[model samples]
Target: MGIESVLSEHRTFHPDQTFVDQANVSGMAHYEKLCVAANENYEQFWADLARELIVWKKPFTQTLNDSNAPFYKWFEDGELNVSYNCLDKHLNTQPNKVAIIFEADNGDVTKVTYKELYEKVCQFSNGLKTFNLDLGDRVVIYLPMGIEAVVAMLACARIGLTHSVVFGGFSAKSIQERIKDAQARLVITADIQFRGGKTLPLQAAVDEAFNLGGCESVIGTVVLKKSKDPIELDSKKIWWHDLIKNQSTKCDPVFVNAEHPLFLLYTSGSTGTPKGVQHSSAGYLLHAMNTMRWTFDIKENDVYWCTADVGWITGHTYVVYGPLAMGATQLIYEGIPTFPHAGRFWQMIEKHQVSIFYTAPTAIRSLIKASELNKESNP
Candidate 1:
């Protein structure tokens, strides 16, 4: 017999009138109009967005290439850089605009502006070049969620390198498998990760992954110094600060074909082996930008917050690429929602003046449980 459902949800909550009035998609009519436009001419719909949103070195002639079924291509002939769309284009208008507002596990906050972020990304991009990596080369980023993680991803994107970001929470075996599969030539990670009011070893995991074999393609490891504790550095180890210290903060963006890969994010491998999912430059940016605008109704001055690790796809699309592509300010927290106290996330939202928040159902459920427990204890 089929399993019977024990839970049901029939509640429907409408948006506040204030929100509806100011949203990018003001009402159902506006949303339907967008859907109808796309449904009428799907390719042209995307093509128009690509041209309007992205600054291309060479504009695309063809929108969708489906000559080979199931192995489709998009904006195949265009030339553009993903990092430029996210960072460089925003420099002239809002260089001083806050791009990332990072909240540390200990409740410390650091704000990075667009111009500062651009310079740092360029410096790191130049540092990566010193390793003699060729275009389209794969780099494995195993860093925790922070400004450096975003920098590493953008630096790779700036120079036409494809990055595969492994979750910091993954085991060494998982990291080894992904490194082997990507044939990554370089690995970027922090010496330690701060989370849940505790410091955890991160570089050690990379070391163990390398020692497990099959990571021969990796030539070096760039370690970001986070902890005061001393750690052993080998020949293959390069300090992230040292690598970029002598480099110029002006690495030009490497424009590649629109179909060129931007990043490779792996699946959880819950059922089987983890698979690397590749996203192309033009199409992915177009989707991320549109969705950020449509779903979040992101405004210029609004401070957005998405509680997801960079290792996951949601973080990739929303936390880093999507918000940056839209030139929206975002908050990045480097700890669990319940760290230090049950009211951590709530306090942060108010402290940062976050206008929009996005998170997973699991996080919401956990927060609810925390609230219930807190009420019982206090009462």
Candidate 2:
């Protein structure tokens, strides 16, 4: 089952003939020289990328200062806003480009262009201010994938709030633990999560976490309506639609120090205590942006898709930040792969014409197993 053994057995390979070969026309040979320079001077490599790849309000003079040992800082003296870097710079040319294509499990589809997304971010950011959220404040997002989930993250970035997005499938106690750890004052969630033809009460789960744990820091919960289920909202609960409806879409982006905490992500630990990890602003932003370009070969014309939920680090870095920073169109699905049929993933590729697709190995294996079963049945 080893990949090395399989390759040794075949002893055959073929180059990808259908590759568009854009690099051949665009300084492909010079890339090798750049690679050599990077290998020789990594500091200069990062510094050059920081300067050219992203916009900084106050550029850093120093590329890196590893004097602090394992905790190194890059572009330490710089100032920038993640929201501005991802949205503002692309407005002129890519205003109408589809930034996010959302497909629900129930066959409903929605698209948000760059211009519209920017406006929505601004509106929700202003709405966040209405909640009296200060800079560096923590906002816990418990919504499923869609425009609102995407907007919640960007809105927090726009206002310098630290958002912690809890995965939709987490248990009530798990959500309580993260909310308690972050001491987040605001909770953003949806009425329901639709997956595998089942309705999970995402907002109800948040309510249970709050009711049981009673985190005193929580001021109110913002709820997005994905289902028409009857619900009662206490004074502490707010409808996301109504909250942002009257808000203006003209909030200015907040610029913070390069090392300012962008967000906190909580992950399970074998020791049973969930660990909360924080990423710095400038370093993390540039890392995601540069890696998206060099690693994924993403371009303006390409349609990209990273099949991961925003609750995890992979989704946060690749699905949300990376493509957005590069102004690349991305497909976001709000369902499991085998929802309608086993061939759903392939159908999506044809439907979206996705050029660059990224997914987890578990999904790949699942597809392989399903295909083998199908072959056996047909044969």
Candidate 3:
């Protein structure tokens, strides 16, 4: 059997079926050749790909420049906001296009269109502006995968705020460490997360962290009311829907310097503490967008499924950054794969007809274990 068939045994959707219809290139060996060729002729490769995928405000005269200390600068002196390239240019052509498909633990699904996503992102950006959070300020987002999480991250990117998204499963102590390290002025979170048939008290954890006073320096906190039961808040907390929806959807994108700090993604330190890895906007976008286009071979009609949580760079890059930049239809699920059954992810694939499934090795192993359990039980 081929690799696609092997993947289909675990895949929620069938391969061969037109999941993703278009791409600039494909194949492992082909990608190896492309990468080797690009490294050999780096300038031409980046220049050609940028011209093909992105709408540049100022066409680049030079592609790769690494003179900046510890910084990789691509298309330096280019004057386009990364968010602008991702959203505005595509709006005219695919305004009504599906951008994000959200699947929750309770079997509920919601689709947000590009136009709707653009408006929501703008509103969230304006909401941040209302807090006087501007370029270079840090925002911490600890929310589940859904339209709001995606919008919040992009909104921070839109106005040049360096956002650090903490995984939903992280402990309060872990959350405090990131918030304190980023010196975040603002925080966005949901009251509770429904997963594995249990109510995860995310708000309570936030409250505990705040009580520890590690994040006392934060200027404001925003809460999204996902559940009906009201979650308590301090004088510092504000309602997300109340703060964002009223804002204008026409905020101009903030064009940042090429070497500006785009974000700080924390990884596990050898000593056990998480160390934040800083990334630059231009080069990071170039790498992420190029990978998305090639890896998924996504087209206009493709319903892409990136089965990773938003907390990891995988989700941040593939699920939000990569797919949205290309204007591909994306499916995001918020729960454990076995919450209802091992087949939950596959069910989503069948239901959404997902293409381009991306997930972690941990999950693959889990599914394999689940298959073993099913066989043992059935026998």
RMSD of each: 1.4, 2.7, 4.6
Taking all chains together, the TM-score of candidate 3 against the true structure is: 0.89
lDDT of 1 by residue, 64-129 (tens): 999998999999999999999999999999999999999999989999999999999999999999
lDDT of 3 by residue, 170-190 (tens): 888888888888898998999
Residue 180 local lDDT, model 2: 92
Separate clash counts for every candidate: 0, 0, 0
**Top TM-score hit:** 1
| Model 2 score (lDDT) | 0.89
Ranking by lDDT: 1, 2, 3
lDDT per residue (tens digit) for residues 1-379 in model 2: 7555443454776436454365322344667877898899999988988999889899899888899989898888889999998899899978999999998998788999999999999999999999887889999999898878889999999889999989898988988998898999999998898897898889878888987775789998999987786777889988998899989988999999898899999986548889899988898999899889877878779999999999999999998899999999999999988777778989998999999999998998888888898899999
Error of 2 at 181 (Å): 1.2
Candidate with top lDDT is: 1
Worst 10 residues of 1 by lDDT: 227-236
How do the predictions measure up, each by TM-score?
0.97, 0.93, 0.89
lDDT to native, each model: 0.94, 0.89, 0.81
Task: Answer with 2 or 3, whichever has the higher lDDT.
Answer: 2
